[model samples]
Each structure stands twice: as structure tokens, then as C-alpha cells.
Target: MPEAPEADLAGFVRAHDPDRFLCTLFAPAAARPALFALTAFNHELARAREAASNPIAAQIRLQWWRDAVEEAAAGRPARRHEVATPLATAIGAGLLDPAALLAMIEAREAETEEDGLETEQDFVAWLRGTSGGWSAAAGRALGADPEAAEVLRALGAAYGLAGVLRSVPAHAARGRCLLPRDRLAATGLSAESVVATPHAPTVGALAAEMAAEGLEALRGARRDIPRGAVAAALPAVLAARDLMRLAAGREVPAPRGIGDRLAVTLAGLRGRV
Candidate 1:
């Protein structure tokens, strides 16, 4: 396996996952490596499909990560690659949960399927495994107890929904749709229509409604995370901002301005998201 470009996992996080990298700035120094490791792992999973030549290749790639998770969980050295090296350390130190890691890997399989999400419930369940699982693991790594970790899991689902909305265009490019098929049909759009005309006014309307729901979820998530676990929850702030931008007819995954950075920094200082 190719090693991480370098030992500094932060470089990978900074380049590929700047939002999480920004959040990592607020984490304790000793905990930052694990944060970088997990974030890098997530970035890898997120891009696996695009990086692969075909769906089968993508599943094979994801299976490799799954095996790495099993190796780490079994207390074996799965450190041949850069991510696996630090990830194994995190698992060994018991700061991360193998189950959560497995869940994340499992959830990415949805992307490989020709059938998009059939219902809102399906979308939520997918998020529950992807970003939701990641946030819960990050919260626990930052010392959240079981209850708070569960809260973080829900918050992460909301965040993941916003992320999917932001990536509508990208998925369309791949002739895929991540929105619930029923909801898409409610807007007079089908899975094929969404892939064909991603920016249709009806699609925008549906995306707006979904964005509003995500914002509401973020509002409900407030006061759920404790001060110690707030850093992991800060992505909820980013999620809220993304939802609002989506509402305003802006392309998401856009560049973060100084104001955005300041907002996150302030939230971190206040120990809340």
C-alpha cells in the first residue's frame, strides 16, 4: 500500500477535509493525531468510489479498509500504510471504536448501488452510519460518555444530510442521486431526472426544503453536547452554514471565508456548536 504522502496526517486533513482540520485546531494536542487519522480515514472512504474504475473496484477498496479495521480490532499491526498506522494506534489506545469505523466503511457501500435512497428513512439511516458514526466516534475520542456520544451521532446525521445536498451536482456528474427517490418524485423529479437536470427549479425547491429540515435538526442539537465534547460537534455549525447557503441558492463546498473561520473559532471558544 502506498504510504500517506508524509507522516503528517494533518497535511492530508488540511488539504482534503479542511472543515475537520479547522475543528482539529480546537482539539487537545495529544488527541489531534487520532483526529487526523480518523479524518483521513473518512476522506479515503468518501473518495473511494470516485477513485475506483468501477463499482466492483470501489467495493474491493472499501473491503480493504474493512479488513484493516478488523486487523486493528484484533490488536494486530495494521500499520503498513499511513492511515492504518495511526488508525491502529488510535484503536490500540482505545480512543476509537472499531465498531464505529466498521459502520462508516459499511455505509459507503450505498454509493456502489444503482438504486438510490428509496425513502427519507433510507437517507437518514445511511447518514446514521456514515457521518453519524464518525461524529460519535470523534465525540468519544474527545471524552464524551455514551449519552453525549449518541447525541453527537444524531447531530452528525444532520450534518451528513447537508453534505449530501452540497454534493448534488457532483453525484449527478456520476449519474447518481443521493436524495430520497420518493422526495425527488414529490418534486416531479425521478432518479434519472435528477441525474439529467440536477439544477432544475423543482430540484432546487426540494433541496431547499431538505436544507430547512437540516437547519431545524441543528437547532434541536444545541445544548446536547457538553463543553468537553464540543469540538466534535462543531461540524454542526458548518452544517448549519451550508444549509443556509443551500437555501440562498449558493453552491456549497465553496471556499470558506475569514468570517466562517471566525465563526467556528468563536463557537469553539464558547464551547458550543
Candidate 2:
């Protein structure tokens, strides 16, 4: 095996983010190395997009990140990017699933660029494409067949949607609103109001709606995947699901709002897997 990258992808996966670590536990051991690298690349990319000193520069950097992901999908890794190194390693494994990865990058790019979600459809597409994409990639790494992969993708999306809903307040603080602007308007809630007061009842109601939709989607997905993998991943999903429920009830904090639920998710994944 190649020597581990300086970032040490596996250690990052193990040491940070309980929800992601919990979700990764069900992945086939054969896929862990590549999966860890892919995830590490994404984590670094997300942080960089948010932390760049200049906002314009941050957008440009995020664009470059998208280009790199596109290159990975094309089987030609972008050579100079730091995150690209480990990302390319994962791509080389032939287990990283380019379609899902590319979709995720594209969705992230859109989220970085948008002022606010103009429509419910746009918001749904972003969630299904990004988080759903991550779930699909995870499923592809662990599942034995295409059908299994599809089911896993849906479950991943369901779980991811819950996370997104729980982070509504944080997204608002950053001047980005993931909830549909049109839907908020329908409820007489302005995006400005949400930004001003991230804890509005309308925001809580919208988050609850999104979480409910995710649960329905997950139920549909669960019927198709293998029982063993489904059993393994369900605990994490349920934990996230519960957090969504709590956020809907106006019980959690901001983006880190799901911290307690994440602990439950980790316990559930370890116990079940």
C-alpha cells in the first residue's frame, strides 16, 4: 500500500466528526482507505471555502475545487492541489465512484454561489445532489450490487437532509439560507428575518418539514438494500433523524446543534455494526 498522506485520511476520519465516522463504520473494509481520502478531501474543501480571507477569493477557490473534482471524474487528477493528492489516490482505487463525487462537488459549488434558495425544488435538488451524493458514494463502496447502491444512496440522503435541517440556524448566520425562500415567503417569513433572528418559529417549522420528507424517502430506500448493511447504517441515520426531530422542536443550538444527537449516532453505529 502507498504510504499514508501527510493528512493521514484514516486518522482524520476516526478523530473528527462523530456523524461521519459513525456512517463510515458500515463501509466495507476494502473501501475504507479510499473512502477516508475522499471524505478528507471534501472536509478540507468545505472548510477552505468558508475560511478564505477574501470572499471573492473564496468563491474563486471554490470554483477551482469544483474543477478539481471534475478532473477526478474525468480520470485525470489535478496535479498541484493539496487535497487533490489523496482524492486522486481514492479515485485510483476504482471504488470512489466518480459520478457521486462529481455531483457532490457541483452541488457544493452552487451552495457557495447562491444568495438564497429561490425555490423549494432548488433546495431539494441541492440536498439530494450533495448529501445524497455522499450517501451514494458510501453505498457504492460497501454494496455488492447496483440495487444495493441505490438504496444506500437514498438512506444517505435521508440522513444528510436531517443534518442540513438541523444546521439551518448556522447557515443563516453565514448569510446563506438553505431553506427555500419561496416556501418561507409562503409562510410570511422573509429571508432577512431569518438572518436577523435565526431562531424564528417559521425556520423551525421548515426544518421539521424537510426532516419529515427525508424520513419518508429513507423508508422507501430501506426496502431495497441488503438487511445487513441497512441494519448497520440505520442506527446512525436514526440518531440523525432524532436530531432533526429535536431541531424541529426548537431544542438544539446552531450548526453544531446536532452535537448530542451525533453522540447517539456514534453509539448506535458501533453497537449495531
Candidate 3:
């Protein structure tokens, strides 16, 4: 039977990312406590960046997370970090990777900065290295073989690319652009034009084209995911991608509403399982 969401730190993990909590599928019940605890810890650290109410606070909190990550790597534990306790416990249980965990924190640090993404290539690289990096971590957690790891990394890159594509409208609304300025230039669309648009057909075409590429990459990696509990998560990935596609179409700032999205995503994942 499926375990309750509240089991261990599952609910806590979900609070950080309801969407990605599905990725824990293949973890054995014996490992759930450790896994949940690890995810909850990571999620909380991650929240420092995402939930930062302002840039200064975000940078400060992100710095703190970076410090905690560095401390954890040095085998020096900090008492102020609630997540670190469970994280250390999970590490003791062989349920954690210090490098991967640090990498995630590093990604958040990058996200906190306002680095300009001037071209499609630059944007792609950032997405692949950051969000895609997390996908690699997930693969490592799954006992992914080398070949499987490569496939998962590729899949992660694809998802990252897709995520950027889907968030184009949202990003533009926030005065951020994940798409490369060079690519937009080629289309005769400046970043300013993109945000000021009343919805241009060309923009939709660009978004759709990018989304398609991401979907293609995802499909190619589909076979790499093993069957069993891990496989149960495939649908959630696809559904989230689709939601991004929808958000692109609407050109909305915040993407889709969480409750409705969760219902559709959970139902799809359950059906697939």
C-alpha cells in the first residue's frame, strides 16, 4: 500500500516542493525515513532562496545556506539549522551525498544572483547545470548506474530547458528573461518587445518550439528510468512540463494555481502507477 504523506518528514518535504516530492517513488519503505528527512532538509535550505521576500534577505539567507552546506562538508555541524540534524542523520544512514547536497545549495546560490542570461546557449547551460544538476542528484539517490546517470542527466537537462521555455512569459513579466537575447534577436524580438507584447504569434511559436525540444529530450530519456516505484513518477514529470506549456500559452506571471495543478498531476501519477 502507498504510505501516508505524513509518514516521517514526507509532509515536510512536500512543503518545499509538492511537485518534486513525487520523485521519491523508488525509495524503499525502509529508506523513507532517511529519504524524507534528507529531502525535507534540502527543501528547507532551498526555501531560503525561493521564499526570500527581498533581494537583500534572499542573499543573506542563501549565504547562510551556503555556509551550512560548507560546514556540513567540513564535518562541522551547525545547531541553528533544523534541517541539518535530520540531514546529518540521513548522512549517517548512507542516505545522503554531501557533494550532491552542496551542489544543490550552489545552484540556489546562483539562482539568487541576477546573472544576465544573454543568449539561448547561456540559458540552456544554466538550466542544465542547475535544475538539471538536481536531476543528476536524484539519479544518484536511485542507485543509478553510469549509463542510467548519463540518461538521467540528459533528461534533467531537457526538463531544465523545458522549464525555462515554459517560464518565458512568467520570467518576462518579472523583468527576467530565461531565453537568450541572441535568439530573441534572431526572431526580431527584443527582450523589451517580449514583455510589452499583447501576445505575439511569433513569441508563442518560439515558446512552443522550445517546449517541443524539451519534450523530445524527455521522451528520449524515458526508457532510461527503471520500472517499479521509480517509474511511478514519470507521469508527474510529464504533467509538470505540460503545465509549463499551459502557463506559456497564458503568459501568466505565476504559472498555474497549485491546488488545481496538484489534483491533475497527482491523478495522472496515480493512474500511471
The best candidate in terms of TM-score: 1
Candidate 2 lDDT over 1-273, as tens digits, reads 344564466677666544565555555666666667666666755565467665466667767666766677677844554457667766766767666676676676665553656888887777666656665666566553677666555565566566666666777777656677888898888778887877877677766776666665555555455543443255335535454565457454433346555564554455332
**Which structure is stronger by lDDT: 1 or 3?**
1
lDDT for 234 in candidate 1 is 85
Candidate 1 Cα errors over 4 Å, as ranges: 1-7
Residue runs of model 3 more than 4 Å from their true location after superposition: 1-8, 33-59, 108-115, 197-200, 226-273
lDDT score of model 3? 0.58
For candidate 3, lDDT tens digit of each residue in 131-171? Answer: 56555555556566656655555656665665566666666
Candidate 1 residue pairs that clash: none
TM-score of each prediction: 0.94, 0.77, 0.71
RMSD of 3: 5.7
Residue 96, candidate 2: Cα error in Å is 1.3
For candidate 2, the 10 contiguous residues with the lowest summed lDDT are: 227-236
